[model samples]
Target: MWKSHPKALPYLFLSEMWERFGYYLMIGIFTLYLKDVEAGFAMTEKEASDLYGTFIALVFLTPFIGGLIADRYFGYKKSIVIGGLMMGAGYMLMGIHDKTMLYLAMTLVILGNGFFKPNISTLLGNFYNDDQYKDKKDEGYNIFYMGINVGAFICNFFGAALQILLGWQYAFMAAGIGMFIGVVVFLMGTKHYGDKTEKKGVQEGDMPFYKIVLFILLPSVIFGVIGWLIKGIQSDTNLDSYIFGSDSTDAFIFACIPVIFFYGSLYFKAKSEDKRPIGALLAIFAVVILFWAVFKLNGSALNTWADRYTDREITGTTQTVFNSLKLAKEIEYKKDSTELYDAGFRLQKENGAVKKVVDYPIYFRNVKEDKKPEEGSKISIWATNLSQSINPGWVIILTPLVVAFFTFLRSRKKEPSTPTKIAFGLLISALSVLVMVAAVQIGNNGTEKVSVWWLVANYGVITIGELFLSPMGLSVVSKLSPKNITSLMMGGWFLSTSIGNKMSGVLASLWDTYDNKANFFWVNFALLMFATLLMFALLKQLNKVMKEKGIN
Candidate 1:
C-alpha cells in the first residue's frame, strides 16, 4: 500500500489505524455499557443518546483549538503524542465505574481527540503538498481513510469478545492498549515526517492568539451558558421549550456562532489570491454537514434498529462458530427479573391498571408472544456492536474497488472534480436512506424482526457515498488551504462534521417519537437531497475557483 506513496505514509497509516482501533473499540460498546441495567450505568435511551452525541461533538469540536495550538506552538508530533497518551488514560479510566470518573474519562478522550485527530491528517496533507505527490492527493486520502476503517472494522471483534468473555472493564483496558500502541508507532516514524511536523506560526493579517481566545473561545463559552441557563417562557419539557430541541443542542449552536464568524472573517481577510479557494471550501463545508448528520446515525438510531428489529439469532454451524469466537452470547429465554431493566422498553400502564412488564436482555417487547422463545431455553444472538462494524466493513471491502473506479476515470482524463464528486455523493447517499425506508415497511415498523440483510444493504450503499465524499473532503482541504493555516482549515472541515454529528444525536433521540419509522428515513433523505441540490447550484462557481487556484 505504501509502494507509490510518500515515505511518511506507512507510519501515519499504522498510527491512525491503531488510534481508530482504540476510538472505535470504545465507541462500539459505550452506549451498551451505559444502558446495561445489571452492571452498567443504567441510563435511559434519551439520556445516553444525549451524552453520546455531546461527547462525540465535543470530541470533534476541540480539534479546532488543537489545530490552532499545533499550528502556532507544539507542531503536529508533540501534540499528537500528548493527545494519544491522554486518550489512552481516558480509555483506561472508563473502567472505574463511577459517574464522576466516567465524566472525567470522557473529558480526557474529548480533549485528546481534539489534539490528535486533525493534526495527523493535516500532517499527511502536508506531505501531499509536494508537486511529486500532489495529483495523487485524492488517492492518498482514500488509502488513509481505508486505514481508519481497517481499525474501525477490526476493533469491534475485540470489543465484543472482551466484553462477552471478561467484562466491559477489560474491553476498555484493551482500548487503552491500542492507543498506547498508536503513540509508539507514531514515534518510530518521526524522521519521515520531521519536516512536515514543524509548527506553522501565524503569518501576516492572522488573528492574534489572545484575540481569538477573547473574541471566539471565551464568547462561545458564555453563549453556551446563556443557552443552557435561560428559562423558557411557557413550556414544560426543557428540550421542547429550547431553541434547538435541547440545552446541549442550543448551547452547541450558540457556541458555534463565533466560530462560524471567525471562518467567514478568514475569507474577507485573506490575500486576494487566496480568497476564492477559501470561500469554495467554506461552501463545501456547509453543505457536507447534512451528509455527516445522516451518516453518523450508525451508533445510535441504526444500532437500535439492529438491536430490536433485526433477526440476530443463529443455529447449528453459524451458532457454534459465533459462540466459540465470542461474537455472540447466549440470552436465556426467561422472565428476567425487574432488575434486567432497559428504560427504552420500561413498563407503561395500560387499561387503567399497572402490570409487571418483564424487560428481558433480548429486545422482545414488540415480538408476538407466540413467536418468542420458550422460557428457560437459551438462544444465541450476535452482539449488537457487531452491527456498528458494518460501515467500516463495507469500507474495507469496497475502498479498493472505489479507488480503482476513480483511477479509471483519471486514466480516461474524464474524472469528476472533487467538489462534483461530493455533490453526486450526496445524491447516492440520499438513495441509501430509501433502503432503510423499505426495511421499515418490511419489518412492519419494528413490530417484527426483519432480516439482517437490511442493515447490511443499507450500510453497503452508504459506504459507496462515504467513499466518494469523506476523504475527498480531506483532499480538497489539502488542495485549497493557504500554507500558513492548513491545519486550521482541516479543523474547519471537522468543525462542520462536529455540528453534523450533534445533529445526528438530536435526530436519533427523537426515534421513539415517530409512529412510522419510514418517515424518519424520509426526513433524512430530504435533508441529503436538499444538500445535494445546493452543491450542484454552487458547482460552477466552485469549479471556477478550483481552476483559478490550479487545483481539482
Candidate 2:
C-alpha cells in the first residue's frame, strides 16, 4: 500500500491503526460495559446512550483545541504523543470499576484525543502539500481511512475475547496497550513528520488564544452548565424538561453554539481569496451533520438492534464451529442472576454520584414463552460487541473495491468531484436505514429475532457510503482550508462531527419511545434523505467554489 506514496504514509498508517485499535476497542464494548449490571455501571439504555453520545462528541470536539494548540504551540508530534499516553492511561484506568475512577479515565481520554486526532491527519495533509503528492491527497486519505477501519475491525475481536476469557477490565487494559504501541510506532517514524509538523504562530487575522478562551471555551462551559441546570417546560418527564432531549444533549448543543459561531466568524474574517473555500467547507459541514447522525448509530441504536432483535443463537454444527472459533460463548439463562443484577441498578456514576433508572434487562421480555430457554440452562450466543465489528468489517472488505472503482473513473477522467461523492454518499447511506426497517418487519417488531444477515447487509451497503463520505470529507478540508488555518478548519470538521454524534445519542436515547422499531429507522431514513437533498442543493455552488480554489 505504501508503494509510490509518501514514506510517511506507512508510519502514520501503523500509528493510526494502533490508535484506532485502542479507541474503537474501548468504544466497541463501552455501552455493554455501562449496562453490564453485574460487573459494570448498570445503566439503562437511555442513560448509556446519552453518555455514549456525549463522550464521542467530546472525543471529537477536543480536536478543535488540540488542533489550535498544535498549530500555535506544541508541535503535532509532541501533541500526538501526549495525547496517546493520556488516552492509554485512561483506558487502563477504566478497569478500576469505581465511579470517580471511571470519570477520571474518561477525562483523560477526552483530553488526549483532543491533542491527537486532528493533528495527525493534518500532518498527513502537510505531506501532500508538496507538488509530487498533491494529486494523490484523496487517495492517501482513503488509504489512511482503511488503516483506521483495519484497527477498528481487529480490535473488537480482542475486546470480545478478553471480555469473555478474562473480564472487561482486562479487555480495557489491552486497549491501553494498543495505544502505547501506537505511540512507539509514531516515535520510530518521527523523522518523517517532524519537519513537516511545524507550528504556526498566531497570525494577524487569526482569533487570539485569550479571546478563544473567553468567547468560545469559557462561554461553552457556562452555557453547558446553564443547559444542565435550567428547568424548562416538560412533558410530564424530567428528561424532556431541558432542551434537546436530555441535560447533556442540551449542554452539548448549547456549548456548540459559540464554537459554531467561531467557525462562521472565520469565513467573515477570512482573506478575500480564502472566503469562498471556507464557505464551501462550512456548507458541506452543515449537511454532513445528518450523515454522521445516522452513520454513528452503529454503536447505539444499531447495537441495540443487534443485541435484542437479531437472532444470534447458535446450535448444532454452527454451535460447534462457533465454539471452536471462540466467536460465540455459552450464556446461562439464569433468571435469578438477572434479578440479582437488577437489584444493584442504583450503583454509582463515574463521579461516585448515585444513578437511578427503571431496573429491567428487557432482554427476556420479547422472547416467546415457548421459545424461552429453561431456567438456568446455558445456550450459545454470538457476542454483542461482535455486532460492532460489522461496519468496520465492511470497511475493510469494501475499501479496495471503492478505491479501485474511483481510480478507474479517475483514469477515464470521469471521476466525481469530492463534493459529488459526498452527495451520493449521503443518498446511499439513507437507503441503508430502510434495511433496518425491513429487519424490524422481519422480526415482527422485536417479538422474533431476525437473521444476522440483516445487520451484515446493512453495514455492507453503508460501508460504501462511508468510503465515499468520510475520506472525501478529510480531503476536502485539507484541500479547501487556508494554509494558516488548516488545523482550525479541521477542528471545524470535527466540531460538526461532535454535534452529529451528540444528535445520534439523542436519537438512540429515544429507542424505547417508538412502539414500532421500524418507525425509528424511518426517522433515520428521512433525516439522511433530507441531508442528501440539501447536499445536492448546494452542489453547484460548492463545485464552482472548488474550481475557483483549484482543488481538483
Candidate 3:
C-alpha cells in the first residue's frame, strides 16, 4: 500500500488511525458511561441518547468554521495540531467526573474535532491532486478509510479492558493518551507535507472572514438562542419546553440554518464553470443525510440493543480467554439484592424526590428459566462496549475485498460512478435494518435475548454500505470542489453528517415509545430506502456533472 501511494500516505494513515482510536474509544462508551448507574451520570435512556446525539452533532458541526479558517488563514498542519491538543486535554479532563467539567470537556472535544477532522482529510486529498496520483485518489481514500476503521476496531478491546480493570476515568484517560500519540506521530511527518500544508488564503469574490462572522455566524448564534427559548408543543418528554425533542436538538437545527444557507449560496455565487459541480455536491450532501441518520444509530439505539437484548454470556474456552484479557466481567445472580421493576424502569423516592431508574439487572429478566444461574452463582458476560467494534471490525475485514471488487470493475471499465455507488450503499444499508427487524421477531420483542450473531450479521451488511458511501463521499468532495475552497466543501459534507447524527438521536430517544421494537428498525429502513430512491432519481444529473468535470 505504501509503495503505490505517496510517501505522506503512511504518515496520514497512522495519524488518522490514532486519532480515530481516541475518538471511537470515547464514543463507544459515551452513552454507556452516561447511563451507568454507579460510575456514570445516571441519565435515563432518553437523556443519554439525546446528549450523545447533540455532542456528536456539535463535534461535526464545528468543522464548517474550522475548514473555512484553515482554507483562509491557519493552514492544515497548524489547525490539526491545535485541534489534537485540545481534544487530548478534553479527554483527560473528563476523568475529573464532575457534570460541569464533563460539559466543558465535551465542548473542547467538539471544537477540537472541527479543527482536526476536515483539515486532515483535506490535506490527504491535496497529496492526490497531482497527476501522478490523480487516478488513484479513490483507492487512496479507501486505504485511508481502512486505517480509520483499524483504529475503531482495536480501541474497543482497550476500552473494555480499561473499564473492567480500572474504571471509566482510566478508559477516558487512555483516549487522551491515544490522541497525544497521534499528535506526536503527525509532527514527525511534517516535512513530508511540504507545500501541501500551505493555506489557500482569500481569493477574488470570496466572502471576507469578518463578513462571514457578521452575516453567518452571528445569525446562527441568534437563531440558536431563539430555538432554545421558544416553547413548541406539550409532550411527555417536553416538560422543559422545546421545539424539537430536546433543547439541544432545537438549537442545533436552528443554528444550522445559516450554515446551510451559506452552502446553498456557494452554488448560486460560484463562477459559471463551477456551478454544476457545486450543485451536484450539495444534492449528494442532502441525500446522504438519511444514510448517516440510520447508520449512526450504532452508538445509541444499537448500543442499547447489545446491552439489553443480546445474549452476551460466554462459557468454556471463550469465557476463559475473555476473562484472561479482562474483556469480560462477572455479574452475580442475586435476585433478592436486585430491585424488582414493573417494567424497564422503576420509580423510586429518594430524599423526597421521585426518580426513574433503569433496572441494572434487566439483562437476566428475559433469560429462560432453565438457563438462569443459581442465586449465588456468577455469569461471565462480555462488555457491552465491545459490540461497538462489530461495524469497524467488518470494515477492516471487508475493505480489501471491496477495493479488489471495484478494481476488477475498473479494469473492465465497468465501475459505476461514485454517485451510483452511494445510491446502492443506501439500498444495502436499508437492508441491514431488516436484519435487526428479524432479530426483533426472533427475540420476541425483547422478551427473550437473541443471539449475538444477529448483531454481527447486521453490522456486516451495513459495513459494506459504509465502505461504498463514506470514503467515496470524501473522494467526490475532493474531486468536485473548486481548488480554492476544497476544505470548506469538506465541511459541508460534515455538516450533513452533523444533521444526520442529531436525527439519529431524535429517533433513538423514541425507542421507549415503541412497544414493538421491530417498528423502530422499520422506521430506519424506510428512511434509508427513501434516501436511496432520491439518490437514484438524481443519478443522471450527477453523472452528467461527473462527465462535465472529465473525471469519475
| Best-performing candidate as measured by lDDT | 3
RMSD of 3: 2.9
**lDDT by residue for model 1 over 315-358, one digit each (tens)?**
99999999999999997666544433445434435686645454
RMSD of each: 3.3, 4.9, 2.9
What is residue 140's positional error in candidate 3, in angstroms?
3.4
Q: Compared with the true structure, what per-residue lDDT tens digits does model 2 show for residues 203-244?
A: 666767898799889988988888888766877666467767
> Which residue ranges in model 3 land beyond 4 Å of their true spot?
130-136, 235-237, 270-273, 337-339, 342-360, 483-485
> Weakest 10 consecutive residues, lDDT, candidate 2?
337-346
104-149 per-residue lDDT for model 3 (tens digits):
9999999999899988988998999999999888788878888899
The 10-residue segment of model 3 with minimum total lDDT is 336-345
In terms of TM-score, the best-performing candidate is 3
For every model shown, what is its TM-score relative to the native structure? 0.92, 0.90, 0.93
Better of 1 and 3 by lDDT: 3
lDDT of each: 0.87, 0.86, 0.90
